[model samples]
Target: MTAPASSSTTPINKQVGFINAFIAATLMGFVGFFARHIDAQGDFIAFSRMMCGGILFFAIIAYKGRLLELKEFKLSPTMVLSGFFMGNCLSAYITATQHTSIANAVFFIYIGPIISTLLAVIFLKESMKLATWFALLAVFIGMMMISGLMSIDSSGLSFGMQFSEKTFFGDMMALYSGVGYGLFLFFGRFRTEVPGDVRAFWNFVFALAGITLLFVFTKPTISQMTSTDWMWWVGIGIVCGFGALGTCTIATRHLKAAEFACVSYWECVVASLFVGLMIYGEPLSSAQMIGGAMIIVGGMSEVLISILGKSFKRPDNVTLKAGSI
Candidate 1:
């Protein structure tokens, strides 16, 4: 039997989605750590991630007695398109990193949120609240700070950065990755009839296919990987791939695209923290601290406002029934 659409989400469900999104973001933050330890190329690692994650996802469904769901799964245009976009998002991002500076790649990749927000507003007709606008601006500024594109100096704030033609292809790839990411988020919401698990599984399937094609073209040295490398690849698959994207897929069911995009900024913040504290052992710069705080505040602004607003209006004697939610 097909899973029903989870369109009528309650407040409690939204809160749960928020929590899952947060956890997913946190897990995604450690991806860099795993990538650093793996001796494989970016595309190969991405391939391994999709391969292992897809297998694990299938296993989970079987364990849950939902394997029959796959038998009825038919390819929809939305599913195929979304899967393609997600695949490109992952592979293009890694390829971009190999060609350009990490800062440039990250800055461009995170632009996906802004694109997603715009697409949601235009296509999904989701209303943009005032707080959401402010949050978006704050998060954008925070990203600029964290990415080193906007810096504060004794002379004053400087905002200009130059790019070289040598990295032009990489920059374009990064921008394409952002577009792919945005499109994936949009299409994820577009086809809510599909269960989250099924969507996620197809995502891995298409992603693996795309990455494998890339491998065929680039011919990465996958044969050189050792047992330790394989272990790291598996870790990346289980943690960043399955753990993060699985929850993220679920989150899209309860949250509007824009809201989810804002919440997803937590990944950048957590990743920055991981790099500064765990990987590099470097202290966070003033800009980073400010940026991180802004991201947290901006991301939580709507939820916090909603909670506080409810508290003021809710009666002390009122009790919610189990069925009310």
Candidate 2:
């Protein structure tokens, strides 16, 4: 049998792992900050991030002598499709951030888990526990609350359906981003041969190429951005794109998925803080706070059930898994 991970260096390793995970999550939370500062269109921002991050990802692989690993395992067609979905997600998110409050954008983007679960049930013939169904309902209710369609305002069950046009469009974009990300997750399940880092590298490569093709029809707003904006774009690409992805990938090797998830959820809370207190100064309304809580609880409930249900889990069943990439 292999030795337990509780060796002499285990404590130090665990400490480093926790720090890396925290840093990664914190950097992800700063995505809205960078997006707000960068004066460019969403697609252009997405393209820049993908191109720069892909370069860095490939450079790291080459430096580490893993570039030749491509000969042993090429990216699958499914991975290319997954990358396309990821590009959609990134593009939508940047646009949503520009139009909506960061809290709303981040909260709704988490709907990916619910969408991915439903897609798995429909497409992959997966089964979910009763708890998973309830969680889905909770998330739906939370979404309605966040959208201002349904809320428990101070007047008690107020039908204060007041959604500005920009926010409404932004909320829809955020929801679309979640669906795109859900599809990305769904397609990613089929890439069993490619290592995670290699898959990430190619995913960004595909995203860069796909987004570049779109620019041929429409002018990229990058042409209008100032030098300062370019700096911020680079920062987002290196810090939020590559830095967060690379560190989070490493953290998984040291921590259980459940432990890493607990860390990952903090990204939303941290983002809310930045959005409300630092960046936008727009606090989450009472209804939105309750809704956000429900969303988090619902998503985490499904994940917890999966972790606890040892025998009930299956590798091919997406409902029984919780992942972020």
Candidate 3:
């Protein structure tokens, strides 16, 4: 009844996980588009996302006659903690978008990778070499450029002062979201024994609880939404909220924390593509073009190095698995 047994992941699973993570990232890229269509307060949207997604997840398990699986494992405190962080991440991100520029919000949320990297190194004992650090630096620079901050002069301190007072709070919320995301990633890897679905289900349950509590406190709105609004919320819940988030959690099973951190940058790149070509119908800015190129270069460098290193290792483990990295 509990989660599936924890087993050594095969090369195939790792590769699948890698693909899933990127796919999830791509799906997440369109979140803004959906947000534009959904007419609701951020907290309400956050709560609805968790509640709807969690319900659907459980519904799937029940349909498969796997509902009993919930009873097999007593939910751990860590699971509860992970859910709280996950909910906080979602709430903060949604609210951040309301207050800050999309670019700034996206960039700040990605600070999760750096925090995740530090946690993985200290607690998970993930190994890293100088090359990886250099790659991370490249990623950071690329992020700055993509966020449209590369042109700012730090000496003038004008950039810091430029933010409106109202937006400053949003920036902090985005930063907090990143920390919550880092903690969520850390706790997600705490128990490999749990199947990704089981973990995701419980995490959603707790996230729903937290978000619902927030909704109760905020009372953002009680007016009836149109059918179109309902449809948009449903799309977001099914696609971005459940589908994207579920795959992200599933990825933790096969990929190490640090590896996932490296891969997370793809979200920004993917989002930018959507924003530029589809939504805005604007050409890519020079900074965006340069930044996107660097992000790809840096991300691919790390992935290639990790994959090739693992593939060329001792004869005991010789495989050119794409996700082995």
Per residue, candidate 1 scores C-alpha lDDT tens digits across 1-325 of 1222333222224575677778878887888888988988888777766787689888877777776666565767667777678777888899899998888888888888788779878867767778878988887788777767777889877774558999999999999999988887777775564556776788788877777777777788978888999899999988988888777776775567777877888887878887657778867778877888888898899566544554435643433222211
Quick one: best lDDT, which candidate? 1
Regions of candidate 1 where Cα sits further than 4 Å from its true position: 1-12, 305-325
The TM-scores, one per candidate, come to 0.88, 0.70, 0.85
What's model 2's TM-score? 0.70
What order do candidates take by TM-score, descending? 1, 3, 2
TM-score of 1: 0.88
The candidate, 1 or 2, that scores higher on lDDT is 1
Collision pairs in model 1? none
Task: Please give, for residues 1-325, the per-residue lDDT of candidate 3 as tens digits.
Answer: 1222343322225565677677777877777778788789887777766776688877877777767667765788778877888888889888888888766777677878788778777877767878788878777777777666664344531232146787998889888888988888877766655656777788899988888777766678737678898889888888887888778877865666666766767777777777656687866666667777877787777777766676434342323222122
Please write out the lDDT profile of model 2 over residues 1-325, one tens digit for every residue.
1111232212213334455567777788777788778888888877766777789978877877777765655556777877777777878777787788755666566666456556655665556667767776775666556545566756776544334775998888877888876666566545433454676777787777777776776476556789999999899889887777556544543433333443454465556656545678877777767765875686567556655675324332222111112
List the candidate numbers ranked by lDDT, top first: 1, 3, 2
